[model samples]
Target: MKVLLILADGMRPDSLTNIPQAQKLIKESAYTLSGETVSPSVTLPCHISLFHSVTPQRHGTTTNTYAPQVRPINGLCEVLKQADKKCAIFYNWEEIRDVSRPNSLAHSCFYAGRRIGYKEAGEALTADAIGYLKKYDTDFTFIYFGYPDWAGHKYGWMTEEYLQAIQSSWDNIEKLMAELGDEYTYIITADHGGHDRTHGSDMPEDMVIPVIIKGKGFDAGKILENVNIMDIAPTVTKILGVTPDEEWEGRALI
Candidate 1:
């Protein structure tokens, strides 16, 4: 089964209430509002844990900067590439480029949100992703929206600006789904949540995220428990019939 993984960086679980598309997915999919992210609760580290199925301590990257793994373990993209599954990525954060190894992606598009406006970058990335998905038979596609994180950092979490950003993200999600149709198993999640004006804490406001698994084989409206960021890779590999790396510490939700 093809997988479309969408991540809204620094999106809090409670903020999903303001996003109609997220609420619809939650009502129609197996989901958890209390999914746990790794310690440090930072963007790059959380993303590494999500893709590598390990903690930041294991991955040795606790900040936004990318670092080569001391003892490298295969990431989701690497494993998929080895299995000849076409993979693509569309994101605004350049730091996230480290999630996959070089040459592993069949298609990649990036727009630096820090330079251009985050909202514009997100919309353009979504449009590009939709076009690429339609043009290529990609097995896995990762689309990341960075506006929420930018809004949170600029205007604080749950503030009017942050909620507006969440709304905009949902608008993009609705557009993407409408264009892509039902050919993919869509997984929507966040790398981490934010509190006040900053994160990187162990508090629930920072560590708690939402996980929505919507597609075939998953029970609609099922409420899940004990979901972790690390579980995402295993779950995606499972859907694609690929074996998880031996070092991966998470299990498939299905």
Candidate 2:
């Protein structure tokens, strides 16, 4: 089965309020609102863990800057590429480009969110992802929406503007779901949550995230427990019938 992973950066589980698409997703997917992200809870580090299935210490990316792994462990896309899967990425954050090694992706698209604004960037990205996924047969795809994090940082986390950002993100998600249907195993989550205008702390406000898994094998409305952002890659590889990287520390969720 094809896998589609969508991440809304800096979205707290409490921040899912009043979003129509998010409620629909939660109602239709097996989800956990208490999923934990790695310490530091920064964007690039948490995402590295999500893709590599390891913590910040193991990946050595404890901040927004990318750090080459001490002993390189194959990331999700690399492992999928070795399995002959066609992988693609659509994102607005440029730093996240290092999530996978070179030559692992079949296609990659980036929108300059910092320059053109993340909301506009996300619109262009979501449209491109939907169009590309429909026209071609892609085995694995990852789409990142950086607007929420931007809003959280610009305004304050959980503020009206931040909530609006979350709502706007789900609006894009709704559009994708409507256009693509449910052919893919969908994994929706966040990189990390924020408190006030910043994150990177070890507090629950920064560490707790939400994970939603919607697919054939998952039971809708089932409340999951003990979920982690790191588990996403393993679950995706398992769903796609590909092998998880040998060095991955996260377990595949049932």
TM-score of each: 0.99, 0.99
lDDT of 1 by residue, 44-148 (tens): 999999999999999999899988899999999999999999999999989989999999999999999999989999999999998888898999999999999
List where candidate 2 sits over 4 angstroms from the true fold. none
Q: CA shift at 165, candidate 2, in angstroms?
A: 0.7
Per-residue CA lDDT of candidate 2, range 60-128, in tens?
Answer: 999888988888899999999999999999999999899999999999999999999999999999999
Model 2 local distance difference test score? 0.93
Candidate 1 TM-score, true structure as reference: 0.99
**lDDT score, candidate 1, position 100:** 94
**Model 2 residue 116 distance off true place after TM-score fit, in angstroms:** 0.7
Please state the error at residue 226 of candidate 1 in Å.
0.5
Once all C-alphas are superposed, what RMSD does model 1 give against the true structure?
Answer: 0.7
**Candidate 1, residue 35: lDDT:** 97
